[model samples]
Target: MSTHVPFNALRPGVDAADVRAAIDRVIASGWFVLGPEVEAFEAEFAAASQVPYAVGVGTGTDAITLILRALDIGPGDEVITPPLSAAYSALAVMMAGARPVFADIDPARLTLDPHATEAAITSRTKAILPVHLYGQAADMRAFEGIAARHNLALIEDAAQAQLATFDGRAVGSIGIAGATSFYPTKNLGALGDGGAVITRDAQLAARIKRLRNGGQTSRYHHQEAGANSRLDELQAAILRARLPYLADWTKRRRAIAGRYRSASVPPSLSVPREFDAGHVYHLFPVLTSCREAFQAHCLVQGVETLIHYPVPIPRQPALAATNPAMCPVGDRVCAEIVSLPMYPALSDDQVSTVMGAFSSFVPPTR
Candidate 1:
């Protein structure tokens, strides 16, 4: 059997010596939690993001939840977001004591549709949260307009859009607050789990910092209750190693997507239409009515494929009583989406083999 192409190809882009040096430096310092590595990484990440502030946190989920808590968004507040995103997006809202209102996604982009977002708003709505799904920017322009009109905060879920842009500005910099994940597979991934919040507002930055460190003003001096969600020194150092290559990796992802588009795609399958949307192509999702059968076909061809999301949040049993609003587009897309291998480390031959599998696929007969 041929080796299966992986969805993510991690190469440890930094030299082994460099990684060892960083580890040695951190160990020698003996100050791990909320230490210099984390501080320096935050500053570097902020500079790379073109934002004035960056607060490192334990995970992407905590990043979003912390931003919500710092913004004082809780209790009866309702946050409007697309149901097509990771469950963590909705969970963050719930974690902050807010209700997550479901909204439809743009069928073409598979991201939060700004018009649908506005339509889903109620008097209880306090913010508009948009996820930059699949490494392509959401319609931030429209979302910004709607948020301004409604006097709601605009929080961007940039977990997959580390170096992605929207209308000439970095996605994270445009929103009042934004969150990102540095999971091992992200374009600029860390060696382990990590996340951050970016903002231009100084006050919000300070609040997020304090919140991440147990709400302490100084050693055991609790100003207010907060969670222990600080990003650790080891992971921060690893991410710092990867930050410089973000652009190159994103370029590789885009190149792969371009080849996939130009390949012989069967009429039964659909590729995303974001060639000009500054898409980083974190996952190259193809849509087919027979997703399961198509996956089996890929497996038989010695290629591995995965689903970006197999279920829509509105349909989640835990959310049954939130009386989740219907998102027909998101629901339909969820059933049909399949993610092909996507990552910067894929070689040209690997990409060709994956495309060849798609070109030769036959639809399952009903």
Candidate 2:
């Protein structure tokens, strides 16, 4: 019988007992929304980020939107973001009533190129939203310098980067405000949809808190226009349960990435770029010349793979009115990229099995 390796192997290494225990405790408390569990998770998360405060929200989208809104970024303002990223990054800007200006990424690191960011700046530019794509930092120190000179808000989209660093500094803690997701598949995922905004600014944190909770600092007092986006108690408890393991989980992912880098393989299939610092490897994406053929082969061999994003945000039907242009590198990378199975509990045998399938296809000459 042939063994099958599923695409992500969702929520692997989770102890059912741990989840049950957290659930039981939450049920007993009867405080569901923005209660003890949420508070505890926020505190724990803030500490993890090396920041002063973190506010849990409904989703990563809301986390970015709320932080932008709190910073008073609105219709007349423009926010610079990467051209190649999850649509949510640009969508968050629109949701905040701001214009999202796209800057091309550094092809090697797959992150916002600082020079492109500087060039994209205009009179209307109010913030720079640099996404830490694929569990690696987007040169925050460089962005910080640019933002400081331009007096722009430095917002970080660290959805994929949990405990990943640049020059040994945390992504979330470096920016003015950083947003993260706890979607089912994230390195620090919750049971369901959840997210958080982290910042060192006490006042900004307070403003974001109000913006997420119907614009009220107190109960039933509508202070400003806001939206309903709170992290549920159950999700918070689950996140708290997983919090302790995040660092170790990241280390394991790095080890797996190292394995892939050192392994002898076909040169036709491009591996991820080498980095000087740590990368959590949320998805160990590989680039292939014949992606469709590769995917077909993997499927026939009882292995599953997925594309992180097939279409760029600009090409989406919803953004058609926006007239977003074609990004050549972004389009090329999207067409060629495929994520392999990666998770904390993934076994060495599984890794070998997956790699063995690719070994059949030899490297083609230039």
lDDT of each candidate versus the true structure: 0.87, 0.85
Q: Which stretches of candidate 2 lie over 4 Å from their true place?
A: 362-366
Model 2 scores worst on lDDT over the 10 consecutive residues at 357-366
lDDT tens per residue, model 1, 1-366: 545687666767444566667777888888889888998999999999999899999889899999999999999999998889889998899889899999999999889988889888899999999999988999888888999999999999999888788976897888899999887777777778889999999999999999988899999999989889988998888777667777787888889988988998788888878834577888889999988889988888778999979889988887787788989999899999999998877888888889988888898778
Deviation from truth (RMSD, Å), model 2: 1.9
Show pairs that collide, candidate 2. Answer: none
TM-score of candidate 2 relative to the true fold: 0.96
What's the TM-score of every candidate structure? 0.97, 0.96
How well is each residue in 1-366 modelled by candidate 2, as lDDT tens digits? 446778875653655678778989999988899898999999999999888999999999999999999988989899998877789998999999888887777878878889888998999999999999888888888899999999999999999987877888878888888999999999998889999999999999999888888998688999999999999999999888888888888888888777767766676687868574667788888888788888887777767899977887777787676656466777778888888888888788777767776666553343
Error of 2 at 324 (Å): 2.4
Q: Pick the candidate with the highest TM-score.
A: 1
lDDT value, candidate 2, whole model: 0.85
